[model samples]
Each structure stands twice: as C-alpha cells, then as structure tokens.
Target: MAEDFTPPISQMQSTTLTDDSIQFENFSRRVLIKNIVGRPDGGVGLAGKKVTVGGWVKTGREQGKGTFAFLEVNDGSCPANLQVLVDASVSPLGDLVPTGTCVLVEGELKKPPTGTKQNVELRVCKVLEVGPVDPVKYPLPKTKLTLEFLRDVVHLRPRTNTISAVARIRNALAYATHTFFQKNGFLYVQTPIITTSDCEGAGEMFQVTTLCTDAEKVERELKQNPPPTEAEIEAAKLLVKDKGGMVADLKSAKASKEELDASLSELKNAKENLSRLEERSKLKCGIPQKDGKIDYTQDFFARQAFLTVSGQLQVETFACALSSVYTFGPTFRAEHSHTSRHLAEFWMVEPEIAFANLEDDMNCAEAYVKFLCQWLLDNCLDDMEFMVKNFDKTAIDRLKLVSSSPFERISYTEAVKLLQNVTEKKFENNVEWGIDLASEHERYLTEVIFKKPVIVYNYPKKIKAFYMKVNDDEKTVAAMDVLVPKVGELIGGSQREERYDVIVKRIQEMELPLEPYEWYLDLRRYGTVKHSGFGLGFERMVLFATGIDNIRDVIPFPRYPGRADL
Candidate 1:
C-alpha cells in the first residue's frame, strides 16, 4: 500500500512557533504567506494565532450579502495564495476588492471548512495599510498573458505565476551551483566583466568604450586644438632629426660623457614632443584616431577592451594557481542572433580544474548537471510542481531521468556517423565528419537516437576553439559538449593544450593575435599542467528546468538585440 502524502489537519494543529517566527518579528511584523500556507501542519498548528500579513491581492470579491470580502493574496514567497476575509466595517471594501491592490492587515488564523482546498485562512480584524490599484488603470489584470507580452513589462511580470516560478527555480540552481563547487574544493573566483582578450577569438564582442559618451568633449577639443597637418608633422620630425644630429656632433667632438649624455637626453625629449604633436594632430572631430586607427589610448583602459564573451580565459589563470576554481557571473556576446537559445547578456558558470583530462571534464560536467537537477527536485519541488501543472508536464520526469541516469558518451566522429546513418529523417545541416554539429543534429542524438543526455567528444580541430588540446592524431581536439533532450547543448568543455609549442602553433594556425594571449601562454611557460574546464549557459539551464521555450522569459531582465527593457 502507498503512504498517504497529505498531512491531516490534526497533525498540523500540534505544531508550535519556533525560531523562524522570531527572526521575522522585527523585520516584517507579518507572517509570510508561504510559511502559513506551506507549513506541514497546514497552518492548523497556528490556528487562532493573531498575526499580521502583507501582500498584493491576486483576486477579491464581495460576499456574505455584501457585508464582507474575501481576497486571495500572495507575497511571492510561494505559489500558493493565502485567503484573507475582510469585513466591510474594517475598511473600505471597495479599496481591498481589486486585483494587484496591496494590503497589510492584522488577522487571526482560523481553520477553513474541512473539505476546502486551503487548510487555513486569515480573518482580518484591522486593516493597517491599503495600497489600492484602480482596475481600469493597472496594466496587469486577472487574465492569461503571453510571455512575449510580459517581456515589454519586465518589472511587473514577476508577480505572474510563470515568472515567479522561474525566479525560484533559477535561484535554486545558482545556490546549488555554489554549494556543489564549494563542497568539491573548487574556489570561486571573480573574473572581470571587461576583458582585453577575446576568449572565443570570434570578434563578436561588445566593445567597452567611453568615446561615444564623451563625443561632444572630443569634438570640442578637436576644434580648439585641431590635429597638426602633414606639413607640421614633417617640421617636428625635422627638428627631432636636427636634435639627433647635434647629439651626434657632441659625441664626435669628444665632449665629456655627461655633456654627450645631456645632448642625447635632449634629443629623446624632442622626439617625444614631436610624437605627442603628431598624435594630437591625428585626432579627428569624431572618435580619437591616429594613422587611421581608432586610438583606444584616448579611451578608457588605454587599450581596446570589451564586455567578456566568457570568463573561461580569466578563470583559467586562477585555476592554474588554485588547482580548482570556478567563475559565475554575467558574460556578454554581440551575436546578432535572435534565436530562442541566444542572449545578448547572460550568466555563465565556468569551472576550470587543473590536473584533469577530457574524461575528468566530462565526469565533472555530468555530475554537476545531475547535482543541479537533484537540487531542484529536492529544494524547489513546489515550484517544479507549479511548472509541471502549467508549463511543462514532463519537467519533473526529465529532472528525475537526468539526476539518476548516467549520460551517454561518444566521440565526435562516432556521433557524426550515427547521425548520418539516420536515413529516416533528413537533417537540415549536412552530417559530415569535419562539419560542426548544428542544433538539429545535437537534438537528434539526444532526443531521437540516444533518448538521454549525450556527451560528444574529440571534435575536429578546425571546428573547435584553439585552446582545446589537440589529440595525438593531430586531426581533432579533445573537446566535449553535453547535449540534453530539450536543450541541445548545455555544457561545452575541453582539456586545455598544456604544451607551449602546440598552443602557439594552434594560435598561429588560427591567425589569432599572439600578443593578447601572452599572459595565458605564460601559464604554460612557467608551470604547465593538464587542465580541463567547461561552461554551462546559465539561462539555457533555466529554460531547461522551467520548460520555458523562450530564453528571454527565463532571465529576470533579459538583454537581446534592440531589447534591454527594465
């Protein structure tokens, strides 16, 4: 026989107030709806207890021959709403009977009718505060709203069921990520949001600049001290040459070493002055420029910089020192993609482990993913249940499957072969050996062929990032991507190239600037070790957990192309 999951009202009635009640005493002066409604005792334990509650009214209606009203209120602590009964004599019933109206009331907890859905409800004795909302004026009403419509009103969407549930789920995942990494001895490192090195080297980066903000000042300065003309620059160079000749003449005349040194120093100062004049002469009426190049020295940082595409490169430095480290923060990409999986700004959880290989990388990725799934199942079951009830019915099952099952692993070559063999369905992208697997191909492997999470490794060198370790065959790199059912690729990782020569060759072969990566190469120069790491797109993870189709809806304040609403 199966055990009864529901707790009896009698069992709940025996509960007593504890530390949680004491903590919120000074701060809120009210019981949170989640505590009263979500308690195992069904709030029966606190029946007849006088408590103050504050929340926005979700729905309210006049009843009992128009003498009183019942308002369903939620404080965003949980999915369930607490029922509050207010009499017409207590306050203006009209003010308390509108949706979105906020209220603070002193009430007595009382048991609802035995067969009712709610185990307890609040009977209000005094209305302390009423933040009324005019039904005709409020934008959000008691109606079903599409996620696309809510994006326009991002600030108020959290009050909705879908967004609130997603918020809770997202929070749970972040907390779980920190807990898992910290428990495994991984140090959390804060990587810079503005970085000089492009981690992907793709050049799709948002340039961080103050030039546009100070365009007026730059234009004014340009007019006040216009850049020197070609003739002026030539004149300065001639003067520098004359100074050099004088210094040389002093040396030829067998003058004292100090006198010769003084002449040489004067020449150096003259050359510097000429250079400064030439630089000032090049400044245009728009952005500062020199020799047709955007002079970032005039901009902030004294060099080119951009919002980071990934924290992997910076965190790798810390990993080399700490042995194991991770960075969790917002990363930006300037891809013009408007797809369901892309975001202009999104968070990334990147973990780099020293002395780990591709296999170890895959294991860590799998384990961390499974840990997140289990964490949601354990700590956020209520929100998960709400999501299952509304958004995705299979969400809970999917979590269970991922949490318990070991992910399937295959080489990139094997995956391509398998994909090609599937003749029943024609793929949009070609399934060739060296071609990069598209989302369609990835989904087919995880959803159709394997029907589970799949880890594809040993990707072709030409298709992967330059930092990935090249295999012995020299044809492919030791890279891996973890593909799940709904989201094709959730995690991308690889064992870094530890050999100094190999990495330099890879960089040169890719035609990337070696100067930007000099610091990264220094890690190999001094103390090189076989290290592996992976990055999990945080928004994609939220989309997977919530069953929310659009990536924009999962994040609190989404940033996409031409859309950065509050």
Candidate 2:
C-alpha cells in the first residue's frame, strides 16, 4: 500500500524539477536570488530551469500597457539584482511594482532576448506571497544616498548597496581575523568585558556599577522582608502594655523582688521587640553608601570595575602560560569625542606573545596587518570593488599595496626628526623629541615620507604606559605603532616591563594607584617571561580594507556621542 501511494501536486505552491536548480530550505518554499542569478555567466547556463525565489523588489515598473510588470529583485547575497517578469493576472501589478515590496514567487528561468541588460530572466508563473509597500512612505528610493544621510536611516541602510557591501566586507574581515590568529598557533582567549585594570588611563573608561540595579535589588529585598505594618506594631505595643501592667501589679502587691524583677524583664523584652518593629517600619530603598560614596562592596562585582578599554592585561596572563594568546571583543571608552574616527564602543584585536621583544612585537604587528589585508583581497574583493565604485576609489588599491609591499620600520626619535626636517609641511602639534607624535606626524611618516606602512618604535617612557619595557637609555620605552596611509596609528604595541621593582617604580612615577594592578604584577612576581603584545582596532581594519573615511560606517551599529540607534 505504501509503495502504491502517490501524492497530488498542488497548483497553489508549485516547484518544477530541474537537474541544475539551486536548492534551499523548503520551509519557505523559495530559493535565494543569489543562487539563481549569481554565477560566472549571470546564470545563463541554467536556462529553462524551474525554481522559487524570494527578495525585496529593488525597482519595479508596469510595462506593456499595464499587462505585465518587470521587477528588479535582490536578496542581498550579492550586489546584482535578478530580472523578474510577472503577468498582471498572476498577481496585482500595483503591489509588485513598488520599491521595497517583498516578493516570493515560483518561476521558470529563461534566457533573455538579445541586447538586454540581464543574461537570464525569471518568468514568474506562481505568485506565492506578496508584501506590498507604500512607495511614498519608504525612505529608500532609486536615488543615490550619501553616507551621512544613510546614518539617519541606519536600520534601512543595509538594504542599500553601500551598507550591505559593508556588512559583507565586515563579515569577511572578522572571519579572516579568527582564521589568521588560529592558524598562527595563537590560542583564542575571551577576556572580560568588565575589568578592573585601567591599562590605558584612569577616568577614560566606562565604569560598570549597579547604581540603579542595586536600588531595584534593595526594593526586591524590602518586598520580601517588608517593613512592619501598622497593625503589627500596634500588637507589639499591646504586648508591651500587658507586660508593664503586670510589672505595676507586682509593685502594688509588694511581691518578692524576684517576681518584680521577672515582670520588669518581660516588659523590657516587649519594649525591645517593639523597637525592632519600629526600625523595620522605616525601610528605605537605595544604594547603600559609606563615607558619602556608593559602597562598591554592595556593587555587582563587590568592587569598582569598568568596561575594559583593552584586553592586553588579561590576555597577557594567558600568553605567559600558553606562549601566545589573542582576544577579540568589544571594548568601551567614555571619550566625549564627536569625531568621525572615534566611537564610544569599538572592537579590538589584542594579541600577546611570550618570549618576544620590541622587534618581535613590530614584526608580529606587521604580519598580522598584512594577513588581514591579504585576506580581504582574497575573499571579499567583490565587496571591496563595490566600495571602490561608490565610496572610496583607492580601496582595492590600498588593500593590494598593504598586502604586497614590505612595511618600513623606523625608531620614534628618527621618525620625529624626519617629520621635523620636512620643511614643506608644518605639523599642527610641535614635533619635539620627547612629545608623542600626533596623527599628522604619523600620516606624514606613512603617507608622505615613506609612502608605505611605517612602524615607529622606542617611544618616550613618560608618554608610554607603565607596562612597557624600559630601554637601556632609561629615557624611552620599547613601544611601537603601525601607521598606515589613511589611519595614522593603526596598531600600538610594546615589549612589557618584566622586572618587578622597575615596573613598581614606573607605576609610582606615573602616580597610578598600585591596588588595581596587583594581579597584573603577580605575573611578574611569580614567573615572568619576555612578552610583547599589540592592539589592532578591528573597525579600523574594516576602514583600512574598504578605504572608508568614517569609522562609524563600517560597524553594523555605531555608538557615539548622543546616538545609539537600533
């Protein structure tokens, strides 16, 4: 009976069989538009195949005197849209001829007539579903949009060519990051989002506390162990009255001192219980404070903590034992910058290596940056080209140059002298020997002077973080910064100070409190090795690879001053 059973094909939702048709999950009963059209030949080879596809109509118009409609549909797999022809009888042409209207239909793939734009066209036979759009209400139109304008409608910008390509490019870069680090034998470590170490600087971090959260906690506790009600307090007072009356009776009857003392003790106990009830009646809900400060012990972590600006300190603990380790995650900064380059929240790629020094740090940074660029060139060239056509012309060129060219290395002092010697250009910041180089100076070294990626090392000890290894001159630290053409300081790194007393003195000289760094110092006190590490701004990598001028455009959701849109 089972072998003889045959199922009837439905006319409502039909899909014809073809040997070459692209297959997708059948719950939606549709295939991705990418599979049907994104091919080396624009899917010309798969002519006459029957398949179902779903996508938002990028542009649609009624043709042939309203008898039929031509729709350009895209599912965001690639930039190209598939040409679709729908008859008026199959579905309402009015609904299908609006921009941003979602259409899912089953059709036969046919080769288009000669001299047309598309190689193949879909002759839609069955209109499975239609999501009508109000053309006037839709923010995205056929007109080109500026990057700044796109930020206003960020939720809808991904439907555009620029943001969608950025999404793909970002995905490729993230995948490449993990692949490169994993392939290099670096163990991936997820450092804490909330951390205690202020490696960058104090007061620049977003402090993590339970200020409001603990107040709610106190409210919950008060509800569970509520204050004494009026009725309960009255009953306790009545008990005290009864005890006092007994004590008075004992005194009037002139009873033995023991009896009188016993009555007095009962009265005292009743009054003490009443006092406790009265105290409970005065319940208040707020964050407990000690010495005019919100007590951190009552906070979530039981001490002051903050969103980490960098994972360098925590990942170093892992690198000491594992030999090499890297952390990739979002870091937060409370910087009040409204610049195109700054974000309140951004991603960081920090890698630490044991048994490495300043030169090793520079080499590691260079190789990592090169690998990221090459990865983009190999995997996301299509998206890169899209950016090249739309946003930045030198995007792909920049990627190729970084991937193929060797980076030039120079010392910090030498770089400063070089910048100072440039009589043609005057830096906004003074180019002194001890002063930290500004973005202009860095760009001069990389873009103008070297015309390639430049690694500047051995920065002033006073300007560098206390963790950096002090050089023999005792005036500078073993630090390095990888500067590129557009982004001046792409990566910053250093060989860590391994000596305990030297670092302790360095910490003191910087006027930093030593309590927060005890655990970091324990790595040096117990067993220390020559470890070096650097942090690469992951968003900057996206910026570098795509040649996008603004840092906010590359990330999916940009968080900055006065803006955190969903």
Considering every candidate listed, which one attains the maximal TM-score? 2
Instruction: Give candidate 1's whole-model lDDT.
Output: 0.90
lDDT for position 558 in model 2:
94
> Candidate 1: how large is its RMSD?
9.6
What TM-score, computed on C-alpha atoms, does each candidate reach?
0.85, 0.87
- Candidate 1 weakest lDDT stretch, 10 residues: 19-28
Residue pairs with backbone overlap in model 2: none
Off by over 4 Å in 1: 1-26, 218-284
lDDT by candidate, in order shown: 0.90, 0.88
Q: How much is the lDDT of residue 551 in candidate 1? A: 93
Error in Å for residue 430 of model 2? 2.0
TM-score of 2: 0.87
Best by lDDT: 1
Candidate 2 lDDT tens digits, 342-395: 999999999999999888888888888899889888877778888899778988
lDDT of 1 by residue, 1-566 (tens): 99745544433344455523311323345667877877776677778788889999999999988899999999888899999999999988999989999999998988888798878899999999999888998888899989988998899999888898899899999999999999999999999999999899799999999987678776888778787788888888998999999988987899999998898898899899898997887565677778999889988888999999999999998888889999999999999999988899999999999999999999999999999999999999999999899989999999998899889999998998898899899887888999989999999999899888999999999988989999999999999999998889999999999999999999999899999999999999998888999999999899888898999999999999999876
lDDT of 2: 0.88
